[model samples]
Target: MNDRTDAGGNPGPEQPGPEPTGPEHTGQPGQGAADGLARRAAAGFHRTEDGQVDVLRTVGGVRGLAESIVPGVVFLSAFTATQALNPSLVAALAVAAAFTVARLAQRTPLTQALAGLAGVVVCALVARSTGEAKDYYVPGFYTNAAYGTAMLLSIAVRWPFMGLVFGFIRGEGTHWRGDRRRQRAYAAATWAIVAVFAARLAVQLPLYFADQVQALGAARLVMGLPLYAMGLWLAWLISRPVAAAEGPRV
Candidate 1:
């Protein structure tokens, strides 16, 4: 009369009760997928064996830094010195293309270099079409705004983006969400990123509107990698878990 049956319809012993499910259980819905994503995100960072994050590595090291900053520098310098949009665009685009080609020649991953090239191309195209050097920075403004808005939204949902990433980095996983202090700390960290984006907009938008290509480009350089590096470092610092206070040494 037992309902449990084997594949051949033979009577079978009662199956074990459903194993408890969660991050610890293989049957937990999405647990494996989430952990996989977390691992990949952590891998993207350059972490020391002890799990300390290297900011330089996160920004893609020296070559990566050059890839991100050089094209903009080329464009700005070329335009500022010559006051010619066509030549400046060409110079910038050439530098970006050179990076992609070099990565290809080295047989390295093309994701970052290709992306940088694409952005440079888009900016150059926008500037070329509009015939305004300032338009070169137009795409940047919207990009910052969009990122800032997305991070802000993540905080509003109580699932901070940095927390999600840092949680895995620190091996706390999503369990950090249950700790009020950790949650608040990560919220602050996420806010640091939002602030970076906001600062860029606040400083560069006015420059854009005023048609100050040289000043805008200069501001962009100052605020681009260096500012972002500082912000990321600050976030990492802010989100570090505080050690428990020692009790009286009895």
Candidate 2:
């Protein structure tokens, strides 16, 4: 049959208009990178409260990660090599000090470097005082326990620490806590942190008390970064939707 036509035998209305054009919604620049980073970074999913995936706010980059990891690694390696506490402590301390000085000289933020230094110094002092290689990890143990307790208690009181911290940073004050849904979401996120801390204690404390310094160090190393990243992911998962549900109003 002949093609359908108008009364004048012209092409029919079924002929399509020019292909639509303009900014695309799906293939936006950097979208693939954002998606990859969100899913892959630290082997966890991370995003912000705006329902947009991005880097986990908790994780620092390569240099910052190095600052945290290197000193501990040095301590573990030195102790394993020398089978002596003082030399290992000195090695870690020296590495931490070098990081701090490098940060200072570069005029960068001293937070991570100084934190590394303080941690090493405290562990060293503890080991020195206790005369045991294992007690070098004591401060970290108590720290995890304290944080775990505080976060769990905050959840019990219906004021999760994640909510408090996020709100303070956003200048939203305590208002988000007033929303029951948001509060519940934050509480879930807080529970993630509590889990992390609890896991650390459960894994590391036995090794600590057993004087298994190397095993404790290994546990701390494995748990610290990866678990913190997971907590960040949980925060984004639980809290972002709450914020999104509230919409852009506040």
Candidate with maximal lDDT:
1
Per-residue lDDT value at 157 in model 1:
94
- Give the 10-residue window scoring lowest on summed lDDT in candidate 2: 1-10
Candidate 2 lDDT by residue in tens digits, 140-169: 777777667877888888767766554433
lDDT of each: 0.71, 0.61
Residue range 1-250, candidate 1, lDDT tens digits: 0000000001111111111224433434666666565555455544556546677766667876787788889999999899999999999999989998998999987766766787788888898999999988887777787777778998999988788767776766666777798999999999997888888889988988888889999888778767777877788889987776764110
Model 1 bad stretches (over 4 Å): 1-30, 40-43, 245-250
Assess every candidate by TM-score. 0.84, 0.73
**Model 1, position 97: C-alpha lDDT score:** 96
Give the Å shift of residue 147 in candidate 1. Answer: 0.6
How many residue pairs clash in each candidate at the backbone level? Answer: 0, 0
Candidate 2's TM-score reads 0.73
